[model samples]
Target: MINASGVLRTPRQTLFWRVTNCAGAQDSARIFRVEKYFSPYTPIKSRKSMNKGEFVESLADRLDVSRAQADRALSAVLDIVAEQLAKGEKIAFTGFGSFEVSKRAARTGRNPQTGATIEIAASSVPKFTAGATLKAAVNGK
Candidate 1:
């Protein structure tokens, strides 16, 4: 519950924490109860995902190369992977992972809207299998 000064009401009603810049506001400091710092009272933010462009910029910085060069390198790697997968060949990076073509057999499926049966055609798709090193890194080992 919220109290008079817009602070959350703790069980003790005497507990309060000085929070600065909560919810990305303009550094507005507020008194929060110890428990209110976790959820609906204030939203939690996770790490942001990196897109291709951002990855290219980061790569350029790390490799001490021009952005164009980094983009071209990244593009080349992707193109090679696609070419290899097109040939039904596997791509492996020892400490990273492997990519291979997975064959999915045709099957019959139901149409939820019409409740009619349909046949799904067989297809080959690229799949990734993470290696132990990558798995450990992801799991923070």
Candidate 2:
């Protein structure tokens, strides 16, 4: 990408090759850049985030079950949690987390663009509180 207006941008480990342009002129020299990837097994990915598919696969491996079974188990657990929260009930898994509904109060908010006053309605939102064991595990204790 061209950047900084006056300066040119080049990525790390970028390979530059010169080729002859045939369409515009006879054997006109043109430069091109090729990007190189360090990983040979898989493309670059973030380890911070795990998608549903990966989670299901991991669950299946750990539980010694099929992917479909693991996915169904996960879906059922999520459905139960959501159902409990919707019913105004708190579901607490000891040493893991607690799921509950949070009540938000109605308040007046100002519109940033027009500087106008707006009435914001109150709502119930789902909240999760991590338990001691979960927090400790995250902290690498």
What TM-score, over all chains together, does every model reach?
0.67, 0.66
Which whole-number lDDT from 0 to 100 does residue 118 have in model 2? Answer: 100
lDDT of 1 by residue, 49-134 (tens): 66899899999989999999999999999999999999999999998999999999999999999999999999999999999999
Best by TM-score: 1
TM-score of candidate 1 versus the correct structure, residues matched by position: 0.67
User: What are the C-alpha RMSDs, in order, of all predicted structures?
Assistant: 10.7, 12.1
Among all windows of 10 consecutive residues in model 1, the one with the lowest summed lDDT is 38-47
Candidate 1 residue spans exceeding 4 A from truth: 1-45
lDDT of the structure predicted as candidate 1: 0.79
Question: Model 2, poorest ten-residue lDDT window?
Answer: 6-15
Looking at model 1, the pairs that clash are none
Across residues 9-101, which tens digit of lDDT does each residue of candidate 2 receive? 243222233333455654445543334333333333334577999899999989999999999999999999988999999999999999999
Output the lDDT of residue 89, model 1.
Answer: 98
